[model samples]
Target: MSKLAVGLMSGTSLDGIDAALVSIDEDKKMTLIDFETLPIDHEMKAKLKDAMDIGASSNELLCSLNFELGYLFSQAVKLVCEKSHTKLSQLDFIASHGQTIFHIPDGKFKSTMQLGEPAVIAYETGVPVVSNFRSMDMAAGGQGAPLVPYFDYVNYLSDETICLLNIGGISNVTIIPKNASIDDLVAFDTGPGNMIINGLMEAFYDLPYDKDGQIAALGQVNLELLEELLSDEYIHRSPPKSTGREKYGGFFVEDLIKKSKLPKEDLIATLTKFTALAIVCNIKAFGVSKIIANGGGVYNKTLMKYISESFDGQVEIGEYPDAKEAMAFALLGYETLHKRTSNVPSATGARKHVIQGSITYPS
Candidate 1:
């Protein structure tokens, strides 16, 4: 049997919404039919960034933005369908990795929240919507993150030990051992990915990003600051761990600025180096023979060059490199509809395999 589905993702980068239309066959093969990224407008982006702040976050605001984001995701689906020349009636379901507002993996009350109400999406799209994909994993005593490793396992399993590195706002790596089984997989956040660098670019240069690493290439890295950054406690933490803006958001970038007297380009260069070094260090520890990289960070040529020079193994781009995360959610939604356990316990440190996501029917 073959089913057409749409996958929606709004990552930590807060850049845009990525929507992917895909076809899944009985054998569980995914063929991406069409994909598009809709840039988030400045006002909405500011509101979302504000909501991430504890002091600024309010019940009424968070409540409204949830539905607002739902509508935005709905629009993304409709646009992708229109672009693909598909109809809503022809779709199976929608898998939405809604905007993550907060993620506290370690605390007395451990929980994660992603808002973009599935009911709203369902109502708008007239299709079943699967949102809140991480809560179930957290309920099972897992980190409720790096959920794409299950998709990685399904698509990238091979005879060689390979690391799948995704560099969005935060970077995470999925380590699959040679001739891997579910139990042999390991994945965790490598540290700040494009988060710090993007923040710096926006603040200092008034640019959305350091396109093609042009800014960083012009300056020299402050190796001392890089060493200090690498010594952060999170960098040394063992697996089954994850982190987000709480640790690397605006405040972190501000502190970096206050600590350094370097020029803007030098600071960016240092931060870029820090990001690549952190990922390289983590991957090197696993001793993987091959590394497959994806996410928004892969587009940074300087960062990619730094990573390539640091690692001796072959570094390659992933399949469907641009839409990898979006496609993963689509696969996860497919698994959920089939009542299959989609979470990898080894990667998430869950007690056992469990079906993830909550489904909302249009009618």
Candidate 2:
């Protein structure tokens, strides 16, 4: 039997809430039924940014954003259903990645917080909700991130080694070697994806992003700046890792803005190379045969150019770039509903593989 489900994802980019309606067969095969991204307004993004600054916002404000985002997530759910002429009653479950406000994956009191209350989603949609996907892994002494590896492994397991790279707010890669089992998976964050680049773009040109890498094409990459950035320890850090806005947020870019004297375009170009190099540096050790790229960064020609240059012809974009994460969450939700473990122990450095996500049911 094939069951219908919805996956909701709101990335660090503060771009929007992505909703994917997916159908999962009894055999665990998935088909994306309909997908949509409902843009978050600037006001909401500003509030999210404020809340992200740990302890900056009042507890009440943080609580409000959670419910507000849940409402927005539910709206996205409803939008996708309407697009596909489906009904809320027809959904088996809704899996939400929620909005990651703060994450401290290492240290004595390791913690991660993804807002957008699942209870609100259940209340509004009258459906089962699977959320807090990272907690269980964290409890098992894992970083509780880069959870997409399970999705990559199930979908693209192949005879030859291949890398599935997603460049969203943060960039990450999942490598599945030849004839791999779940234990053979290798994945980690490759440092900044579009975060630093997009932050610079928004700060300089008042644009959300440099569309198609047009601005960067006109400028030169400052080698000095690139080299200075290459020294970032996180990018070169070994696997069983993950990162987010805490390391590459607006403040990170603001510090750069205060220090750099290069022209805006040149700085953007240099940072784009930095993003590409970070990814390349991390993946080179694996010797994968191919890289299947996805997420928002795939549309940036200059970023792609740098990545493609190193891999030669080994780089290619995956299907439905924007929808992949949401689709993955839908599958994760499916697995959780079936009491299956979806987090890869190797990828997360978990003490053991555990079925992730907390389930919420409608009253």
Candidate 3:
């Protein structure tokens, strides 16, 4: 029998929710039936950004935002179903990658948190919901990130070295050897993806993002500044480690800006160059043969060209279609629902393959 699933993704960029309506056959093949990005309101966006940064959000605020995000996720799912002419009754389940508030991977907390009450989704949609996927991996001694590699293995693996690169708020790459399962994969955060560039654009240009990286393309790169940006110790860290805004975020960029005496345009340009260089340098370090790029970053022509040129013929972009992450997340959710083990133990450093996600049944 075929199963219909709704997958929700709110990336680290704080851009919006990507809703994908997917259908999977008994054979484990996936088809993306419909997809849309639901924009978050400006007020809520500000609140989320604030909370994402290090601060004490009132317990009331945290509780309220949790349910509110859950409701919004449900609304996105409903709109996707309505627009696609699919029925809630037809859905097998909803898989939600909720808004990640804090990813405390080491030191004190040793926990990662993504919040969108699956119970709320289940209550509203009358379908089972599976969510909070990362914590499970972390519990088993893994990075609890780059969760899409299992999906990449299932759908994009070929008889060659393939690097599935996701350029979300934080960039990460998954190296898949020919016919490799999760065991043979190597994955880690490459560096800043779209998040740093987007944050800079918003702070200086009053734009949500640099459209096609036009502003960046107009500026000149200061090679020295670019080198300084790339010298961070995180880039030298070994695999099995992941990063987010907490590391390359607003404050990090602000400090970079404060330390640099270059022109504003030049600064932006250098930062964009920094992002691209980080990817290229990591590719060299990771020994990835061909990189398949996706996410909002791929839409930026300048960024794409920089990466393409950096690697020369060593890598190519977009081996798969757009919406790859959403498609893969849908697959992840499906695997989770069936009680199948989904995480890549080597990529995440999990002790064993764990059937990830908490299931919430409809009332």
Please name the candidate that would achieve the greatest lDDT relative to the true structure.
2
Better of 1 and 3 by lDDT: 1
Model 3 poorest 10 in a row by lDDT: 312-321
Q: Candidate 2 lDDT (Cα, whole model)?
A: 0.92
Ranking by lDDT: 2, 1, 3
lDDT of 3: 0.83
Model 3: per-residue Cα lDDT over 1-363, one tens digit each: 888998889988888888889889988898788988888878888888777766746667778889999999999899899999998999999899899887876664468878778889999999998888888888887778879888878877888787777888888888888777668888888888988888888878888888898988898999887777788888877778788978888888788767878777888888888888888787675456788888888878788878888884455566443467766777888888788989998887778888888888998
In order, the Cα lDDT scores of the candidates are 0.91, 0.92, 0.83
Off by over 4 Å in 2: none
lDDT score of residue 44 within candidate 3: 86
Give residue 154's error in model 1 in angstroms: 0.5
lDDT of 1 by residue, 32-138 (tens): 99999988999999999889999788999899999999999999999999998999989989999999999999877679989888898899889999878998988
Query: Which structure is stronger by lDDT: 1 or 2?
Result: 2
Sort by TM-score, best first: 1, 2, 3
